[model samples]
Target: MIDIQYSAEVRAAKNDGTPIVALESTIITHGMPYPQNIEVAAQVEQDIRDAGAVPATIAVIDGRLRVGLEPDQLKDLGQAQGVAKISRADMAACIASGGTGATTVAATMIAAHFAGIEVFATGGIGGVHRGAETSFDISADLHELAQTPVTVVAAGAKAILDLAKTLEVLETLGVPVIAHGQDEFPAFWSAKSPFATPLRMDTAEQIAKAHATRRALGLPGGQLVANPIPLADQIPSEELDPIIASAQQDAEAHRITGKAVTPYLLQRIYERTEGRSLIANIALVRNNARLAAGIAKALKAQAG
Candidate 1:
């Protein structure tokens, strides 16, 4: 096993068999600006704790793949300049080289599984990018889901991506795409999308049972629990679609490609929306965190 330093809260939680939810660190390093990023991350962690589960916010720093971060560590990471947004490919390399980086969904799953944490909450998983038909810019998150057995709770693929093709590729990879309480798949900041998902489970218990059943059947990979952002917090698709199109056009015109595409699009959307998108994003992440806590508790009960 890789050596990892556990934060006091996570250490105690493990000692007492408390249910723990994993959180990705890229939301701090790449999702938002300094103080706001730290504030948002704390809120999401508190949401899990309020729901009676511990939050293990994963990140790599100073050569350690830490399962949970100390407050000082979180603060420094929040303000650090140019931290590599670590994913499956470079996660190990980052650790080996003693480099600091924030974990993305794919990297978080790799770390969570190593830490023996089964459930994770994130704002949204990356998917096939727009124009992926020609660019073929599918995200590593999809392939990670097909191989890792960690249950991920997210609002869904970000609306900025090619949701149809993302869903199609997920189907091809044999990952379970289960919508929560709704028949329609969620569209990140919005509560629903026109696209249909493969399955829907209305309760956390049901999602937990399905997770256990998959393990029983020796299935590989995890389930994507598509939890929608609360309607009150959502930016309606009708209002946001044109803005998204405009952002994409700007990105294309500016020649932003590959790893740069997502951050570029998100920054543009934030500017265009005048920061409402970030607020909605924080809401969805906290929402996912609460649901993940419930599912983590259920999984513990099932195991016991």
Candidate 2:
């Protein structure tokens, strides 16, 4: 049997068949500091509620795969140290070992699906790294998208990654990359990238309909809804290009590779940008949460 627990509110929602949007725990554990992380998490949850959906923040704690966390649990998680960054490869092991860990995009999708939740909100999905051709360090997020049936709403793949190659891999895997209200795919902090999106969707209802249609046709995997950050919050790609290059160079100089490379580069960029990147990250995540809530609501309505 699966050792999955739902928070009181999530349990009620499940019993009542209300729309519930799944949130990832890594944003609280690994993405930011304590008070800010808790504050942002609560805000995101409230945003989902405001849009008429319940927020189920997924995580694993002491051998239990929690579909949603209580307020105190969120705070405890935010303050915990050395929490495992779980993905498809280690999620079950982490749960089986009674470990406390945060779920990444890939792991979150898996947990959300297990809980019968179909929509997820996240800041960005991981993808091919810059030196993936040599390192072959592609993210499990790609494969998760190709197999999981959860619709992930995000700004897009992190800009620090090889966006072109990431999109190519998603395409080859037959994962639909749908840009929300735009032709160009979003670059985590920015509204547009050089590459075009494979699909364009302008509304939550339309995106939800597409997801339903795919399932109706017996298609495997989920849809990636690449919502753009608000233009006012975006740092133009032109300005970020050089900063990204410099950060990547520093990572290479220090030989940062594998999972370490992303966090290293992100921190370096955050420092180099004087904390602007973090602000942009928060804004994009909130934006994605709002959109994900809308999609979840639409999906629920469609089901009825």
Residue 49 lDDT (model 2): 93
Candidates' C-alpha lDDT: 0.94, 0.94
Candidate 2: lDDT of 153? 97
In terms of lDDT, model 1 sits at 0.94
RMSD of 2: 0.7
lDDT tens readout by residue for model 1, 205-241: 9999999999999999999999999999999999999
lDDT tens per residue, model 2, 66-158: 999999999999999889999999999998899988999999999999999999999999999888899998999999999999999999999
Best by the TM-score measure: 2
Clashing pairs in 2: none
